[model samples]
Target: MNRRERRATAARQSGRTSPAALCQAGFAHLRSGRIAEAELCCQRALTLDEQHSDALHLLGVLCFHAQQPDAAVEWIGRAVQQAPKAEYLLSLATVLERQDRLEDAWQHYSRALSLKPDDAGLWNHIGDLLWQLGRMDEAARHLQQALKLNPHYWEAAHNCGMLLLELGRHAEAVECFDIAERLNRASAALHQMRAVCLSALNRFDEAEADYERSIALDPSLAETHNNLGLLHWRFGRLEQAFACFDRALALRPDFHAVLNNKAVVLLHLQMLDEAFAALHRSLAAAPDDAQTLFYLATLQLLTGDFERGWAAREARWRLPSVGLVDRGFSQPLWRGDRPLEGKTILLHSDEGLGDAIQFARYVPMVAALGARVILEVEPPIQQLLGGIEGVEQYIGRSSTPAFDLHCPLGTLPLAFATRLDTIPLAQGYIPAPPATRVKTWQDRLGPRDRFRVGLVWAGNPDHKNDHNRSMPLRTLAPLLDCDVQFVSLQKGVRDQDRAFLADHHDIVDLTQHLTDFSETAALISCLDLVISVDTSVAHLAGALRAPIWTLVPFNPDWRWLLERDDSPWYRSMRLFRQTTRGDWASVVDEVRVALEGQLSARRSRLVEPSPTPSAAPVPAAATA
Candidate 1:
């Protein structure tokens, strides 16, 4: 009885301990990352007790890590249904996420979080899901809770920063990134994100340094390279920008923003073909990208491909800058499809002042088609444009009169299908007679014998190409010292030019007295000639049919065309182009030579005796 009883008791005790012991050993192996050993132990435990929840959960996790999510879900679902626990539910949710069943995964996550509300890991997962769903505020709240639960949770901190970055909270994102660094996470992603925030805040030097650090850590991050390219591009460092963009493109060929960015750099470099090619690739990648479509239209216009450009450029209203303007129109746009024979067309002022002056030439042509035209123009240019032939009424910005149809001033060229040859300029359309302000200007000038030439060294500083189109006042100092009464025609002066003008008292700074463009036009009418950089004043001179010479940049605006001595847009305008980028020296020299020749001609005319009255009235005298 003793031997039999002893043997039976030992057997029963061994059976009871087998499943629990196996389950414990399986978890220990899993923690040690010995997958095969963990699997063996888990299987043995399940074999001993087929319904063991710990063994089932461990097996499900193994299947998930082994890339068998379907099996993992099947096993974890059974474990969860048998005994409801937060750990089992969490594992099931993760497996579902890997399977791309986000909705189901979300439900499970919510359930798990309800059971374990204070778990930092659970909160992190919830935050991740909310972020992906675009619930940024909620995602941020959840992520913050995760960090509050566990201050050392680097993943949660990093994700919160990423969410903030997307929300355009750059300063906050940078701070969050700083908090994340305390966890000793030194990945490329952290540095890259910090760089993006810094760049947005215009911290260029810090952003560039961070970019370098990120690229050094992980050379394969195409986005990091592309961002660095943008940094370089903003500073006009096209060469460096191109190199970084090319690297990003090679790393990720379908990166649409990168392709678009590369095209911008190419455009600045004046490589039109390469620029368009990059643009095409970007459009192909994201066909509905409104910004890219609008950019393409701008490029087409630059290349003088107006027909296609206009068609694509209709997207201009979608651009942020353009969208900000008051473009509201209850009436339909007249794209020349409809006859304007008897219609009242409201031709509104659009774009810059120069464009308004240059395009006013078309109002007469539009009216010649038997349509009554109303012009809505900027208040400053209203009086100047009032004389335009065919404009039935001149309206200011505050006035919106009744009209049968409406069109932007820019759209007229497209509506008219204007090519280079179709450009029409009614010389002296904006006429300002010499006698109109003769006394006013003469009194101010105090009887100048030298040639009276008006000067404008700069255009609007807000213009994107002002750096190239406008020259320094010092650059024009040589021309000002000549035997001519140099009168400044610039109404808005640069801060840097005040000192230069003060040093040279000969230059008559009449801008202070010039109230509006109309006053400027009257003053200009009393001048012998006008010398100006590419500005609205140049267009005004051209419109008045005054003798004018314009300084053109190397990559001049499309209106000036590529290599032309004269502009079809304005008949009285002569173009003096830069042979090199940002070079105004050559342009100044050319203007000086032409001015000297004019002075010589005037001197000769003054010295020469008037031709004896051609044998006139002699017959009557002889008869007497």
Candidate 2:
């Protein structure tokens, strides 16, 4: 009999066409893209023999092609109930994945992998799904397996390269992108990702070119402009970075990351109000963004808004950028609300030595709260800090101490709810090294009347803001014009600086003999005045209540606050700020003019003159 006659005879004899014939008809209709006919045929077969897997599978796939993933998943799920074939499972997974049921799709994909171990497309699909799930290393490995199965798999290469870029394996990402570029030369995504990797490696010129190329290929690309803005920001091109961020914002107005970046550039340009507005926009979009919170906190602190600033500043402990000083302590943090009465509190140093010195003023206040304070400090300043009134004992980092609660020294102000007006003060808080330690220096010069000034033009080399804050020693030569003896108090001198020191006349090299900060403090004790850039030495001098002039950058640290000639933290400190960033000469001119005035007055004294406030040091802010 002909196939149609046989089907009709079977249908008449058994009350319907056989499931196999119905499935055959369904597939035949499906092959010709007759979706309606295929679906009806599959439904009839399922009604006759509900467990017919192939007919159900065909209908599920047909529904998927017909843009009905919900129906496809339901039909495929029914097919899976009857013994599942590998192909059927894959179709189910695809429909599930389209419905955003990633875990269910992953399980089916895994099952299919077990059935067809050598399928490259299966591996690639699973890899892409894993990438979506953020299993970066696993995704890359599976992608690599797909590429091994088929060497010309450009999609796999690109995917693996993108995961590698996310993982910060820049060189490996570059290698993968090169292979993908050969296969898909016109892809803007490929170029943009390659530029991202290059920028991370600080290959700025090449990265810039690639960013431009990506934008040229796809004018609608958003990330390329954002990344180019970041590259410009890295090299201090503030205006260009701002422009790029503006372009990115035009495309994606609610882009919080771009907004935060634009805020940072605005901050660099000293556009405080604009930066604040940008930060607020970012915070409104992503309130939990730790980096943005900390940035905003710094702005608040800079503007002397301590109440909200300190609360927001606590976000640093949770942020990756700050690395959240994870001491692994079981004790909870003591925010100001807690009563510390009879509690043993471990107050530990967190940041640099200078920070420890600056905030050490709060230690006594903590002790006054009836809390027994155990102070832990950096080794250099351990001895110096031991003299503070509140410490029960000074401990090194290696010591393990049992305490009821603990706080970083930086957190003390926050714990006390300290305001700008309420900052505790104790001049000569840090004592000079013992008389025995300083006797040699005391005996070397028999109290000469020549005006002596201790000088430090540079700070630690590794400080993040050192490039902007520190000046070359040669720039301080203008201070030599005044009739004052310049004494070099700079320790940890670079080899380059040593040559400059040797070339310069009349700078007593005390750095060689200075053993510690105690010795540095003793040397400052002998000087008429101390002049230094923002460094540990400056902090030491300020804490000791020495007549010290702090040479600060235009955008000084938040602790220095904004637009002030005096430090609230140190009563003895007189600030010489750079009106223009990197303009050390103008700062020196003010110092020189002040010194000339002081000496001109000193020379007029009939008898041996004592250094007084008749012609006291001039702050750079005063000069302006």
Candidate 3:
């Protein structure tokens, strides 16, 4: 037992029944975890002297520890009234705060602070309460005061760091974490929190070191493991990421976020069955989790399970990670819930250029339903896509046009109840480029003497999966070696590719003249074929019914289903998929062999001409 317990035992053995002695014995019993004995002692002391403030305070503490907040408040308030002591007031404030009587708690806390003006712990407590109330600025001030009063206050420093981290002030949070670490180097939680700040600042190596240190200090921190897994996931270390997630799940089986994260890595690894199982388990743990549901939708769509995919696709808007704004228009969103005989419906683009291009096919179908369709899409493709058959009006991103109902373009598939077989315009729907624009491209190119191909090797670098979907221009050297005219349809070529492009003069770089999708479309119309990676250009070529061979990654975006050479969404598109992840060489080889075969077939057809008259020579410009 503690020293107080020993003294209390000596007093009891000597038959000392004084009120002060009994109160002391009670506190000793309470400290030693003898709840029944402590309560009996407090009652006996109160019977001897009902106004004994120490006995009353001990009883209040007992009630608090027993989870009787109401009774604890009554006893503590009585003790405060009798003694008017700072410690008694502090106890009363803590109990009142636990009961969520914020005003009462503040009154008691203010009384205690007034009595003990320099109490650093009291300042920290108030700061913590303010943080919970979302009074961030006040919380920071109070926490700073606590630190100023006691520079070595680890708790206050840690609290300040957490607040800064919540505010997305990673650099400031790291400074606070540094202060905390100096005071307590053995704290695993401190290391973990600091690692999160480092990760946010993109100091990956430092973050990894801190994560390792935290795990070494305490292996049971499931949150630390989950965070480390996310870092690994960002770097594409799939196996390591899965291991960390598995460890986190083992520590906390009901960790729904970890389960969801694990499923995402599984999806990237093409372990569809495993990802499906993990997502279901996460839903079982937390059924209404939007992120998990969105991932499940993505997995389903990737595997061509369109029925369930479209059903859950609406969850994307609810996810902060997707960053899709709800637009919150006054008009209700139409999801085929009501007939639209004469109503005007706004169909706006919700995602990237390729997605807008792919889903714009739904405009005609919506118009056929007797609704006036006003299409709002990104400005870059607005001119080209404005000509979609059913679009009565085409506007740029910021328009607030009059419409009876609205829907994001991504949600159109669900509104149409689209399935694998029900995807609209598989034979292509986008109208041909305007004649004048096509003529502009024709004038730019004099003649086509060889097979003409447009090449797009990369897409937007900021895309999340750009590393997987896009390749260096050098990777296409084999394909470019073919005896054919090549024109770069790629915009925004990276600095790494600029030197190669300068050396390879055979490959025409005409992108400087192509300002928007309209210009690109007109140029695409003149080319015999388009060879592109998964990008907006590929989608454009497909929608225009132009011949397109799209190179796909091993684990492609949801649109390109597994192991298929053809796309259900685009009939004119042919897929060339990588057999392994990051193996662009193999894909390039396959495309090169296909190109050579097509050339050989053309030569044979030309020599075997018999009944049909030889056609007029195809202009060499056609090759571009």
Using Cα atoms with residue i matched to residue i, what is each candidate's TM-score against the true structure? 0.70, 0.73, 0.77
Error of 3 at 3 (Å): 27
> What digit string (tens of lDDT, one per residue) describes model 3 on residues 1-624?
777777877877788777788888887777778889999889988998998998889889999999999999989889988998998998888898988987788778878889987999888888888888788888888887888899899999999899988888899889889999999999999899999999989999999999999999999999999999999989878788989998999999989999998898888788889999999999999998898889999999998999999988788889977879888899999998899899999999998999999999999989999999999998889988899898999998677788999988888899889999888898998888889989888778768778889999999998878989999899999877788889999899999999999899889878889988989999999998999999999999999999999999988889999989999999999999988878999999999999999889888987895897889987776453
lDDT of 1 by residue, 196-265 (tens): 9998898999999989998998999999999999999888787898899889989989888898888876
User: Which ranges in model 1 have alpha carbons more than 4 Å from their true place?
Assistant: 1-202, 234-238, 321-326, 426-428, 433-439, 612-624
What TM-score does prediction 2 earn?
A: 0.73
Better of 2 and 3 by lDDT: 3
Q: How much is the lDDT of residue 484 in candidate 1?
A: 92
- Model 3 CA deviation exceeding 4 Å by range: 1-156, 167-169, 232-239, 606-624
Q: What is the lDDT of residue 588 in candidate 3?
A: 93
Question: Each candidate: RMSD to true structure?
Answer: 8.9, 9.6, 8.9
Window of ten residues with lowest summed lDDT in model 2: 1-10
